[model samples]
Target: MSGIILHHYATSPFSEKVRIAFGIKKLAWQSVDIPPVMPKPDLMPLTGGYRKTPVLQIGADIFCDTQLILRELERRHPTPTFYPGLARGLAEGVAFWADHQLFGAAVAIAFGAFGDKLPDAFLEDRSKFSGRNIDRARLKQQAAVMQGPLRAHLGWIEDALADNRAFLFGDAPSLADLAVYHCVWFVRERARSDALADYAGLNAWADRMKAFGHGERSDLDAKAAVAAARAAQPAPVRGTVMPNALGLTAGAMVSVTPDDTGRDPTVGELVALDAQSVTIRRSAPEVGEVHVHFPRAGFILVPAKA
Candidate 1:
C-alpha cells in the first residue's frame, strides 16, 4: 500500500484527471502505460473485466472508475483536498454532467474531426466498445449536431469562471474544476483546432488546471505491475456487512459487469458488498489472488451463472 500504481496511457482525458489528482496530493506513483483500446491483456487480470483507463492500484486491491479512485486517494492522502464543503456535492454533480453530457459531446467532436485520419481498425475497435456502429460519415454528422450544445456548455463554464475566483469553488481547485477541465481538455486538445479558441475565460481556467500537472511518475512494465500485485496480499475489507438488497452473500460467486457497452463481466468470489461499492476476490496465474473493487453505480453484480 506504500506505493501507488496507475494503469493508464497518455492522451486519455480521464487519465489526466488522476494524474493531476496525484499532483495535487503530491503523491509518488508508478505509471504503467496501457492500450488506448481494449484487449488490455496485461490489465484484465487485475481489473477482472473493467477496462476503463487509469485504474488505481495499491498492493493487491484494484480500484476502477475515477469516482472510486478519487475517493480512495482522498482517504489515503488528505492534504490538498480534492473536494471541500458544498463543493463536494456541487463538484460531484458537475462531474456527473461532465462525464456524461460533456464527455459525450467531446467524443463525438474528437472522433468526427479525426475519424478519417484514424486507422480503420482503431475506429472499428472503438465502435465495438461504444456498442455503436461508427463511420466517418456518422461521426461527422454527429459532430456538427453536437457543436451547438457543446458551445453552450462552454459558455456556462465561462460564466461560472467570470466571478474572478481562481478555481471553481474559490481559490483552490475542486472536483468540479478537474472534471470540467478534463472534458474541455479533450475537446480542445483532441480537436486540434480551437474548439474553444474564442472562449477567453475557459482558456484561462484550463491554464490553471494545466499548471497543476501530473505528479512524479516513473515507468513500470505491465509484467512488473502484475507481478507486484501477485506478490502482495489483498487489503482487509473495511465493511462488515453485505447489502441484503442484492440477495447476495459474502461468498457468492458473482460477475460484475458495467451496464454500458463494455459489458464483459469479471467473475470472482464476492468479498464485500455495500451500497457504495462491491469487492470481489479473483485469482489468475498472472495477477494471483487480488481483490477488485467496482463502484456500485453503472455496474451490475449478478450470479455468475445468471
Candidate 2:
C-alpha cells in the first residue's frame, strides 16, 4: 500500500477536498471508512479527540484538518504542486476563506434544502457536532436566508473563471480550487440543488474539477489502519517551535482544539511547531505513539489545564 490511509466517510465535503487533491497528485491511497457522526472509536486513538472527517493518516503520523493535510501531501509529493503560480501563503489564504466562509454558506443552503429528509441520527449528531440545534425547520429557514450569501460567494468563483482559465490560479488546480470544489460539490452533488446553475463558467470549471476523479482508491479495514499505526513509528520531529506569544516549547503538555465546531481538545506533549502547523505527540494502546498535526489557523493551542 502507499501508506496514505484516509479515515473519512464517503459523503464528507472536507474528505472530498483531499480526495480530489489525491486525484490531482495521482497517488494511490488506502481508504478507512469512518462514521459520519460521533463515537468514532477507531479514530480516537489516532487523533486523541479531534473529531473531524477525512483525517489523513500516514503511518503513525496523523494529520488533522484539510488545511494542513494538503500541505503535508504537497510536501511529500511536489510534482503536481497545489500552489501553481501563486505564493504558497496566498493560495492557502484563499483556501481558508473557501473552507470557512464559503463552506458555511453552502452547508446552510444544503441542509436547508434537504435537512428535513435526513435521518434523525444524522440530525442529532450534527447538532452535537456543531454545538447547535439541528432542527429541520430552523435549517430550512437558514437555508432560505443563506441562498443570497451562497450565490454571492459562488459569484466570486464565477468572476475568477471569467478569464476561462483551466483552474482557480491558472493552468493547474491549486489548493484554492480543491477547497472551493468540496463546498460546491456538497451543494450540487449531495444536496442536488441548482445553486450553481446561473454560473455557466463556474459550472464549466466544476466539470473540469469533477473530471479529476479521486485517484486510485482501495478499501482497507479500519482495524488494519490502526494496526498499521501501531506497527510504524512517527517520522522524527524536525525544527524548533517558532517563538510565539504563548511561549509554547517542545515536550510541554498542551492541548489543540478547533476554534469552530467540534471543539474537542486533543491534549499531548508538543512535538513540532512552525508558522503554518503544529504537531503533538499522543499515545494510546490502540495506535501506540502517534504524532498528530493541526494547522495553526482556526485552532486554539494553549498550555493544558491542570
Candidate 3:
C-alpha cells in the first residue's frame, strides 16, 4: 500500500487514463517520467520486456497496461467504486470500444498530420516499435480516409452527452468518461485539432472531464526508480488458483504479450493465473524479484518456449 510509483511520461493518452483515475480517487502517487518512445532502459528492468508507457509499480509489484493498473488502484482504494451497477456493463463496453477503435483512429490522424514534423529518430523508433516502415505518405492518405469514421465516432459520443448528463454513464464520473476523455484530450491537446469544437455536447463533456485534474504527483528520476525497485519486495497475493485454461500452470515459464501493436512480451516464471489477470515473477540484479501483472483481457499469456 506504499510507494505508488508511476513510470509514465506526461502526455501518454493511456497514462492520462490512470492519472484521471487517480484524480477521481484522490490518490497520492509518485511519478517516474519515462520516454514517450522505446529504448526505455530503466523501465525494462522491472517490466522484463514490456516497454509501454505508464507502468504502475507498488513496492516490487509492477503492473502493465492501464486496464490492470486502474483495477488495481480501485482494489487498493475502493471508497468511490469505479463500477456502479447501473452503468457497469455500458461503461465497460463503450470504454473498450473507444479504447481500441477511437484511439487507433486518433493516433493515425496525429501521425499523418504531423509525421513530417517529428524528429527522424522518433519516427525510426516508432517504426521499429510498430514492426512496420514509417510511411508518411500512407499515413497522410489514411488520415484523410479516417476522418469520416473518426467524426462519426465523436458524433455518437456527442449525442450521448446531448442529454446534458454530468458524466457518460450517470451523475458521477466513472471509468467510461475517463476512457473516452483521454482520446478526446489527445485529439484536442496533443494532436491540436478543432474537430470537437463543433460538437458542443462533447466539447462540454471534455471540459468537465479535464477539470477533474491529475492527482498528487512527485517526480522521480529513472535511476531512483530502478533503485527503488531493487530495494523493494513484491507484494504478496492470496489470489485463488483457477483452472489452467491455457493448458498451462503455475511455475511454468511464460511470456505475457499484448495483443495490440506493442507485441513485445514480458517473460517470467508464472506465479499466479486467473480469469482476470496473470502474474509473472521475473528477477534482475537491479530490481531483484518482481511480480508483473497483466490483464487477461488484452494480453496473451503463453509458455515461454512456445
- Each model's TM-score, in the order given? 0.95, 0.98, 0.95
Which runs in model 1 stand beyond 4 Å of their true positions?
Answer: none
Model 2 Cα lDDT, one tens digit per residue, 6-36: 9999989999999999999999999999999
Please give the TM-score that candidate 3 achieves against the real structure: 0.95
Clashing pairs for model 1 are: none
Worst 10 residues of 3 by lDDT: 237-246
Model 3 stretches with alpha carbons more than 4 Å out? none
Residue pairs whose backbone atoms clash in candidate 3: none
Residue 215 shift from truth in candidate 2, angstroms:
0.6
Superposed model 2: Cα runs more than 4 Å off:
none
- Lowest summed lDDT across 10 adjacent residues in model 2 is found at 83-92
Highest lDDT scorer: 2
